[model samples]
Target: MVTIIKGKDRAEYPEFFTQLFKLRYKVFVEGRGWSLPTKHGLEIDQYDDDEAIYFLDVNEHGIIEGTVRITPTVQSSLTADYFSHLIENGQSPRSSRVYEATRYIVRPSQKSRDLNRAAKSRLLAALTQWCLENDVESIQTVIDSNTLPTFLELNPKVLPMGLSYPYGGGRNTHGGGDCMAIRWPISQEILECVRLYGDLSLLHAVDAISSENIGEMIH
Candidate 1:
């Protein structure tokens, strides 16, 4: 079954963060060829250590299936660090209702008839629950284009919130990946999608939510 984890509580979380890193390394770095820093193959960034919240899925065997990263919109420098152009061009919204979703990754082993869908749906449910309890109005994520239609198809309520833009590159980064910001309601559809597809990788969902429904979605 899937589980929701928060903060650094070890007894409840145990080695979850470690498992999370291992899965991240295998997928984001080795499996997907993302140019994340290497040393142990795990992909970690400054964002991982910040005021971010994580939603994790673990299988019956205690293996991590997938993970999603959420951060306060105000804490993220999306307007200043990456999507400045989108903001300056009046393509992105600046609102307190929004939160940023990032660094999503999932293990391939979770792919299955039931598990995939369940994991994804659960993740969305957890996020929506957090939003409702915290009085959050919207969720913003820098996601892929291919997954756009899936997000719309899966949950029509998460309206597109920003312009699309290319992601990762240059001397210290990977290439060709693109992402966009989409907003989710505090409840309702967001919870339903999570209830259905929580087992599916948030990375895949994010990518699926981006690609206009063409290729296989991966984060």
Candidate 2:
């Protein structure tokens, strides 16, 4: 299952945060070899401010499976603070309805390689459900062309905001550094895709919904 977590709630679940940060460290640092700051086996940075909200994917045992972070575009978002040039008109978004999704950390289940695919869909479904329920109209996230297929499995309509640009001013680990900022609309298509692929029902009630479709839809 996935849950929306806030910074203040960190105190109540130290183990969860520790697991999340450890996963982040494994992905971004040890795996990707990014020189990000780490402390006591936890990968943390400035953007993990008080305003940030995270949707965490955990198994039945509460072990972290994947995690995604979001923050208001009105605040210092990844695009506004660092990747503004990728935005159209060279202006970063500033609105409550729009949010930046970053630090998407995922670890595949050791038992099944295909389960990782479903895991991604599940986490994305949870995030999309939360956004639609809370009136978030759009979410901004970065994507590498190589991983575009993986993301497209979540929502077919996801499109880039502007021309591809070098992320981190070309200093990123990706040799070409060709990254694109994408916008995913909070729409029915995403909900349907999530419902079918993730084997999940919409958290927000939808008209003509039933549990029978869930079993029939799972791939």
Candidate 3:
């Protein structure tokens, strides 16, 4: 069972952020042996704020199992922040109906399902639902070389968008685990397929933004 939460304003979903970080810490740091200085035992960065919509997967016990962040890749968020040297033209913030996906983490407590095809399908479904409601047409993801196959397995439509190289010692790649940039088209039908495999929610913008309250709405 997976629980999905969409982040709202800064004040409304504070607990969600906390849980998100806790989940990150468990997956990226403690579970995966990622040696990063995670303050409060959670992995968080400056990019997380009111504008970012968080997709959280929690278990039946309400414990966060996996999580990811999706934010508008407009001019405000230049790809330079994460991968500047790789792109020669330099990343410009664009509101061209694009959404950047990053910070994908799965807790150690839930590793049993990471390789499960059905679970992955459902996760994709929830993501598509959100994109449809928000009118997001383009979606982007950074993949580690080895993990590229995993995303590719999700569908043949997945495509590499920009430069590919080792990221964070290539921990994300399936081989060296070097990260690669990838993108794919998001459609209502495809997202619907994602929901079929797992649980999903279409969060309200106001509630998604509120840091004090974390919630989910089924689309």
Using TM-score, give the best candidate's number.
Answer: 2
Off by over 4 Å in 2: 89-91, 111-113, 168-176, 199-219
- Expressed as tens digits, the lDDT of each residue in 1-219 for candidate 1 is 446555444346547877787777777777656667755655667666446678876667877676787767766545446665544335445556667777665454736655545656666676778888877887776567677886675577766655676766522355446666666667765666555554455647776667875555555
Per-candidate TM equals: 0.72, 0.81, 0.71
Q: In model 3, what lDDT does residue 170 have?
A: 71
Candidate 3 segments exceeding 4 Å error: 1-10, 13-15, 31-37, 75-78, 87-93, 107-115, 169-176, 192-219
Candidate 2 structure quality by residue, lDDT tens digits, 32-145: 666788999899888787788889988888888789999888874777777677777454567779888988976756645457667877788888888888899889887765
Of the two candidates 1 and 2, the one with more favorable lDDT, higher being better, is 2
Candidate number with the higher lDDT (2 or 3): 2
lDDT of 3 by residue, 49-92 (tens): 55787777666776665566887786324354666545433444
Candidate 1 — what's its lDDT? 0.65
Could you tell me which 10 consecutive residues in candidate 2 have the lowest summed lDDT?
Answer: 199-208
Q: After superposing candidate 1, which stretches have Cα over 4 Å from the reference?
A: 8-14, 77-80, 87-95, 106-110, 168-175, 193-219
- Residue 127 lDDT, candidate 2, scale 0-100: 87
Which residue pairs in candidate 2 have backbone atoms (N, alpha carbon, C) closer than 3 angstroms, thus clashing? none
**Residue 50 accuracy (lDDT) in model 3:** 59
